[model samples]
Target: MNSHLPTEKQQKLKQLIVIFCILLITLLFAFTLLIAEPTQELSSFELDQQGQKVGSGPTEFRIHNQQLYVAVPSNGHYVIPEADLKTIRMLSDDIATRQIAVDQKHVYCGNMILKNLNPQTVRSIGDGYISDGQVSYYCSQITERNTELNVVQEVWQILLHHTGIGSKPQSYWYPHYQLETSQSPYQLTVQGTVSNGEYTYFRGKLVEQANGHTMRYLPSYSGSSDRLRESSHYTADGTHVYYKNQRVPVQDHPQLMVFDFGGGIESEFLHDRKTQNFYYQTSPFSQKYSPYHLLNKDDEHAHDPLFLSQQGIYFYHRQEQKLQRTGDNPFSQKLTQLAPDVFHNGQDTYYLGLYDKYIRSGRGTKLCYRSTVLYRLKNAPVNRWQKIAEVKYGNSRWRAATIWKNGAQYYYFDEFGQGQGFDQAVYLIKDAYALRFILNPSRSSDDIRQYAGRGILLSPQVERLAKAKYDENFCVSELWSQNE
Candidate 1:
């Protein structure tokens, strides 16, 4: 073997090297093409199960059973079932009334009588039915009740039907029954008198089996005072008699007084049924310095002292309690100052509404509002706060606030500034769980929009939309998907 290669061998080696280089370049180009393609790209259109191209938008798109549905802003609703193109027939120009209901047996639609006849024909009822619209169908006398019709009118009532034997009225009517219970099996005779006064002893039989009974007592005092008072007692089936201005906490004692707190009850007297711990407020009538001065700077009165957790009874006291001096008063406290309207969601989490601002708390952590922000508390002990959303309050003003569901959802009412005050509209953002809002737009300048909207929870089965990662600065407009 010679150290130097021949000319022919060198040429062959050069050709092989060129071929290997070309192959390597081809593989590299193919790999680059795969990586360059965007993983998150906006789909132009989608196809149905029947290969039909559905329209596209930001919303999550899906096709089920060859049908296409779209999600959009329909009267404040984000998602709606798409109308069937085949069943879009105009049966009649005149609109017909239809009633809808669902039961274990079948889904009912159309008029009450017609729905009863053919209960199974009802399909998915759309939201459009709520508007002034019409539906049509062929009439059929499915039962004998349809053939016979009679109408009558009575004073203070309108009788819609009368069939010689019975009658039906437009308004509701409850039948009354008065049965003599003296002859019944369950009967008892008892005699009793008041301990304080020597009142007259009346003889009366207690009917145990009767549905109910009313007793009218006219106790005439023979003494000097000219004042006369009459008290009547009503017993249901000779048991559980309710007396005026008195409540019986337990049964078997007809004459007993239950615990009653007179006027000035504390504001934080919350009854925790789950833990059986009764949280209440104590009166500040005896204390020289008002609790108001300790908690609130304003002249407003602090009626009741609230007990927080296992900590001793907390009141706005200047010298007695160290927590109060440490700015733990209800008004001056940083937590309450950040959120005046506090809502505890029966769990560790709490929603705070500090004047116009909003915040959330849990364990030992607190988070405040900056813009349209959402905050969540970190896990216990070493609790911390985290930001969720910087949503924009599009066309609404803050009204009231509420925290519910162990801090799962923080809801707030937004005054739509429609001159209707607090009843104008409500805006709700489902924190990081689901980004959504409920809007009730006013019909006119003077009309008020009350509870007329609901936030929708996007489910995969119902709406196969792409899930977005939690973004603290996401807006309502950004969360809304219009695809499919």
Candidate 2:
């Protein structure tokens, strides 16, 4: 035991070694804490459907209950889109007012209302470009198209000026793409790959793949262009696929089946029909919808392109995104298009949604209504329209033969009758789902006629369009976290 004892220097060296070891360990642990990012909580990555981290990179994003915040490379900040949320890039802050209107519906732009304007009757001979008796509204501005004087080759939002087809078709603004075009849209062949003269255009711009000799624009899969194929949706060269205006690398296998959302001008829901893959401007895999379509079209389960699937008559939900199954859609069966967003369903005429002020499609509760009496218009300004019988909602037992309109018609359907027996009826109008009927003006106004129109009195004020209310059946994000 006495020999085992170390010398004075040996004892000092041993103590130094022990202390060095402790300090090394402490330094290593401190360095690890610094490098590992003590603040990181696994939320730096965009989450998958299972709430698991999917991918991580320098890209910035914010995940919250109501929004999927993403960093805009241009602005370098995460911001929420105005409405569609899908096409955040193309949409301006005021794009909320860029809506498609049904007949007799008001056109709201920002804070102003373009009264007496009808989009379906534009002289441009297209659904969007209409010339109503009220006023003319082109895509961008209140410009007029001389369809009688010139033939429109294409109509794009970007194309400001055109030389007309009668003029030399060499260099003119293509109306469809809204892009200046040396090649006519009518001559650009079915495949977006067609090169006129030497250049090819897509998405209101030129295709970089255009080599003047071989500009490819056909899918390797089996299909032809639909009537709406003029827009640059899923176009492929022999090598790569282009979606929305960018190149989809060969690995993505875009040939499977292309699904487009909204329209050619505003394509937000670009996805694969087979794989249910979704895409955005920066990330190829932005979101996903359900893989299968249960209801054909009217069946409602999975037929709409905007990612809105019907669970019931009104209950709608998005398969993988933030939007959940919202209950209630008034219109059922094969809905006919009386105007852009207005549908003529079996016997009811209902507003498509609540966001007329905003251009969103799949949100807001719809109005479902029915009237027994009807008269198909014989000499009405617009053809093929049948006005339904009006029903009042206020403190009156007589619910039929009158509608709520502004200072123009004979009767006012007291729309918001609280505890007035017609509370349910009033709720429909108060909720912006009022079913209004028209009076047969040619008929007589007798004093004894109480159920019938006594005279053409000025219309009374009705309820205003309701604010957008999207009541979800079940929130997926909240449910997922709770289960975890």
Question: Per-residue alpha-carbon lDDT of model 2 for 1-484, expressed as tens digits?
Answer: 6675667669999999999997896676556555553322123234323231112322123334444343222222222333222321211212211322222233322112345554344223132222343353323222223243333332211122121112112122112222233432213333333344554555235666644244344332211124333324555555555664566643334344443332334333334555554443213442343332311111111112222233322112233333333323323345454422233345544322221111223776432221111112211222334433444334445433334332222223322221122211111222121221223333322311322132322222222221213333434443344311
Report the C-alpha lDDT of model 1 over 270-305, residue by residue, as the tens digit: 122333232122212222222322112111111222
Q: What does each candidate score in C-alpha RMSD? A: 28.4, 24.2
lDDT of predicted model 1:
0.26
State TM-scores per candidate: 0.17, 0.25
- The alpha-carbon deviation from the true structure for residue 438 of candidate 1, after best TM-score superposition, in angstroms, is 17
Q: What is the C-alpha lDDT of each candidate?
A: 0.26, 0.32
lDDT of 2 at 392: 35
Model 1, poorest ten-residue lDDT window?
A: 459-468
Q: What are the clash counts of all predictions, listed in order? A: 14, 23
lDDT of 1 at 349: 27
**How well does candidate 2 match the true structure in TM-score terms?**
0.25
Q: Model 2, residue 205: displacement in angstroms?
A: 6.4
